[model samples]
Target: MAAAPTRIRAAVVGTGAIVSGSHLPALRALADRVDLVAAVDVDEERLAAFRALAAEPDETGPGFTVTGYTDLAAMLDAERPDLVLIGTPPSLHRDQTVAALRAGAWVLCEKPLCLTLAEYDEIAAAENPDGGPYASVVFQHRYGSGAVHARDLLTGGALGAPLVAHCQTTWYRDTDYYAVPWRGRWDSEGGGPSMGHGIHQMDLLLHLLGDWTEIRGMAGRLVHDVESEDVSTALVRFANGAMATVVNSVLSPDEVSRIRVDCADATVELTHLYGHTNDDWVYTPAPHTREAADRVAHWRTPAADLPSSHAAQLSVLLDAMRDGVRPPGSGPDARRTLEFIAALYKSAFTGRPVHAGEIAPGDPYYEAMHGGHPDWAPAAATAATSATAATSAKEQ
Candidate 1:
């Protein structure tokens, strides 16, 4: 094991709900190891709330001062923290990540790195190798016990070759949910449910299944009055020859985030929304196969009770950073998830199947997520009537 930094001076940008709910709490949990040096946001009210974090520890402990800044660059120049947690809207990710890395700070960026492949590449370019600062995107589900255990079984051949899978993130997001200026805009949030919501489930799916070869899908604004699609469905083909069906929607009343992978010998599944523990995973061995059943009985499982959270991944990230290794969520690892989304969108908007690496600079989709679809436009008001007269479903 590598020796962690004696004291990591950390700063956080964007004082939104995710920052308060997950990032600040996680940082506080590591209060002994990380110092809350600075908080940056445009809103002073949010910054005031973050200022309260400095008062968390009693006078006896490391009672440090945390400064608030409206400008990220000024904070970067002043505090120069070891880590910077970015929980801002997606549109700002690229510029902020580039600036953070340039400021010699390890970055813990939120999900959906940027709105386009071009932006993704730009962020990747900012990463300085040769023992310089790095950036890690947030895909917390991949760090959960459930996902880790299931990945081990599949890779170790305990679950046999993965044949098929289903990734679903169906959550209810009212029109008011998109009322926030940046909530549903393609330029801001990237894509709708696929980028914001299902991206977590999809990241976990890709983490286990490996690289996806190609995908064909469709996206639509079925309900929510937004610039981006309210729902999206994709048929993805993995490099291992396993195909999966992906559905992301903000219209489901009974919300559920699930990923079920069926292998030749057994079926492994996980069901959870937002986060998951080891108990959320289940194993079902192949029926009527004595050899498979016998092997399944002895299959190894994760013994620890690790829950899915920012702390889970952040702790590990800090460990790696101390050891001088690039963290998990950035670079190629997180980029793959973004690439998968890009391919799915290109396929949907262009009415054609999109192979991996198909979209690049100059590609219509590379600039914007909607890919300049001729018919698609942001809805002023959600179409209340249902469009189920016939159907608009695509299955793998």
Candidate 2:
């Protein structure tokens, strides 16, 4: 008798909104390659809804059973799936991912890997061999065709050396948007625009520009009652000597997400309207002889239809799990992105430039309190708050 084809057994930890919206659909589409074995969520209602969605008949009209669990530990102990998708909130990521890896399940966690650089480092250290059953953060932007093409041009020296990059990510979030209890809280969601909305852009910038050597930034809660900043801007100097300016905000009336890279040879620009969609891109080559120009133009054909960020990322992750290889956007790669944001916050509060290695694990800011949130504020901001609290107590 012929042996059954192998399929990567899969389980998802969080069945919240994103899981139902993007992840469930994407995984179902890859049914032949992946088996949806189990799902876990604290909320029973959410778990039931997601299980029902997952168990529905496929296009071929065949139903599949997806086990549901309210307790993550129990599910892991029983299923021991090959891959685990963590779609939990930012604050819970560190603990969940560490547990998943310890259970011998490879993890594909959602973006802004954790709330702080400290959490990122902790999870990275916990991921045993740095490869399989390890963790991969979901920075879906890295999978877009435009991103792939741009990376080739930048890394292949086709665009010479990167000189400067301008990144802007703006989206509208009104009072109603903060209705969720943890929506704008420092401990729950991390920070405001910089950590939540701007993370994707920051990942793209780091992927394109290499390491950051220094950063100076400013952030504030200009438009919201949230504990974290609603707007932020930062100036970064890359290790390669290229400079960049990043702007992140949720108060913009007209939302725009774009990154323009100016290289020694030419310039490349890409923009997306929504968080997950790539709308347009422009690639310009430096002036050259007629023959050279023709060749460059021939190489630069019109942009083609590309995979959506989530789809592309999911495909690569599944492929990696099956082949026993590390995905390009591993947890370590995603850590750099989070570290950059941590530096940005530190600089914003201190009014001083922060270096790459400035926020070490032992740094006071690595574990500090802001407002009522422990270890949630930027180091400098936490110090300021502590002083104020001390003064208030003295007056009493």
Candidate 3:
């Protein structure tokens, strides 16, 4: 008889909305496979609340009690968990992720992994190459049943060649939303809507479309008084000759997150705001091409409705941990999404198109999303706003 897989000892950092809403629920559901060891948050009250949500003693067997800490270092030392979930702000991600990887714990962090590619590299460099611990960013949409079936169709050329596409994440983020200290800052939250809000749709687009060749775009602070662009638009050209227009915005009252890929023989699309099931996807074959229509119509899809969410992606990550394999969205797979955003910002700031592999080791954009100096670019007015905010705080 086969032996049972060892349960993972898990510690979660940040007891904020994402943790309480998604991470905790998923962890509790898998109580048998995960041991909740510790939770860390700056807010003691929030940490206490998260600790209460830990599974009852019967959930994970007897004598199970979760520890709460207001400091990360103390928790890492005392708990020594195998998996760490980082739901902290963007600025904290680099240091926290690096610390976890160095301590031989695997990590699945919230998105916009860090403020810059350099910091991204730092986290990647800290991973265990001899193959014990690793880190994965959260891009859950890439793992759903609809996405898998769509990839099978495109990769097999059933939809012919992918020619063009459109991806949009138009949502609303008002002044009240950015009232939080970290919301709109480059150093903390990363780029505004593109980094925080629309990253889900954008990452899904990259997953389906594959490698990009060149991209150019612009960012605007239009409506919100935040320190980052509330809206960003870009034109992207893929390595496979596919072109796409991408937009990430928080100014739309009628929020919709959508992606459409037009192939030589058919068009495939997905539309959903926060999460999506296979029902949100649609495929349309060219009217004149009978073979193409039949091929798409007969394409097989998963029997399950597997939707996009933290839970869905965590399932895949857990499997990797159990099997001693690198988790999905790890290293370069996750880095590509962040790289795309950097290239878009570089283009927007430089007033010229930027290509993949353009921002290398020494490139200022590679070091920071706002470049080495935010004020160097006119589009990055947030630098001035941040400075003004800091000044006002000092005066007060």
Candidate 4:
């Protein structure tokens, strides 16, 4: 008998609008490497619509088959997917990811992995000991070509000892954007610009510059009538002695996301428009020797048809799944990022600076800050309560 073909069985949870816009499309792009067997969502209607969309004839290229499920547990029990994509909101990420991991499935969870550091710690501790079915957080910007190039420069010692790092994400979010009941809520989405929007840039900053030692942050509800901050700024101290200033806001008229790193030898800067397409990345290295200047000049020519960060990360993740190895941007990687967010929130609330190692498992605020009753929109609250009651009755 012929040996069985190797296939990376995959499933996606949370068929929210983003699942279609980001995760599904990326999965479609990696169709051959992955078998997208199941999609799970709480909303049956949304799941049905997504199934239709997934089944739609691909005018662009070949299509793969996918099944839909309204129950996550049912999908996991039936499909036994090799990899699971958790695209749920930040608040639900901890529970969903833990459930999937415990159910013997690898997970690629969306960002802001958890709402609080303690929750992040709990999820991180649940990883399989044998390293089968690992989990990764989706910090896609770290996979971008420009970011790759920057990392090469930094790692190659071309820019010696990064002295200063700066990141800015200024994207516009109108009233209509926040019209969604859970859009700007602290309990539901975790936080506003910092956790939801700025996290990508912050991840990139930390990934390149190394871990941060201390952070002092301030957040404010400048524009939106939400419980969380609409604008946030943080001063970060990296373990390598590099310092960084990060600013995130949802009030800007035009979208601009960019980063600049000043090193002992030279300065490297990257500027790109929001949504991360259109060959918009600009990398400028400070002039050093004539040879270095010429090299920088050579790199300045425009390149075409670069993969989106999401696509790049997805490809890497699929390869890792197939190889049964830990992928880049692994769950631990995302957990560290969430730890920073938790520290930032602590700093914001307490009006003090927070250190990375300070958020230990035994900390009083760790578990108390998250879990228990959720802070959500009235409609969501009612629905959640009803669902909880129904589940209790079913279990009884």
Q: What is the number of backbone collisions in each predicted candidate, taken in the order shown? A: 0, 1, 0, 0
Q: Tell me how far candidate 4 lies from the true structure as C-alpha RMSD in angstroms.
A: 6.7
Report, for every candidate in turn, its global Cα lDDT versus the true structure: 0.83, 0.78, 0.82, 0.74
List, residue by residue over 97-178, the lDDT tens digit for candidate 2: 8888888888888876777777777887777663466688888887777777777778888777999899999888999999
lDDT of residue 22 for candidate 2: 70
lDDT of 4 by residue, 13-41 (tens): 98887777787777777776776789998
Q: Write one digit per residue (lDDT tens) for candidate 3, span 1-396.
A: 122148889999998999877777667667677776888999988887767766444342333367889888888888888899999888899999999887778898998778888998888889876565889988888888888788778888988899989999999877788888988887788788889988888888888888888999898878887766889999999999999999999989999999999988888999888888888888887776656544656654555778777777878888888777777788777888899999988888788999898898857687668774454333544565466557878999
Error of 3 at 299 (Å): 3.3
Q: TM-score of model 3 relative to the true fold?
A: 0.90
TM-scores, one per candidate: 0.90, 0.88, 0.90, 0.85
lDDT of 1 at 192: 89
Better of 2 and 3 by TM-score: 3
RMSD of each: 6.9, 4.9, 5.9, 6.7
User: For model 1, which pairs clash?
Assistant: none
Quote model 2's TM-score. Answer: 0.88
Q: Which stretches of candidate 1 lie over 4 Å from their true place?
A: 1-4, 57-64, 288-294, 297-300, 377-396
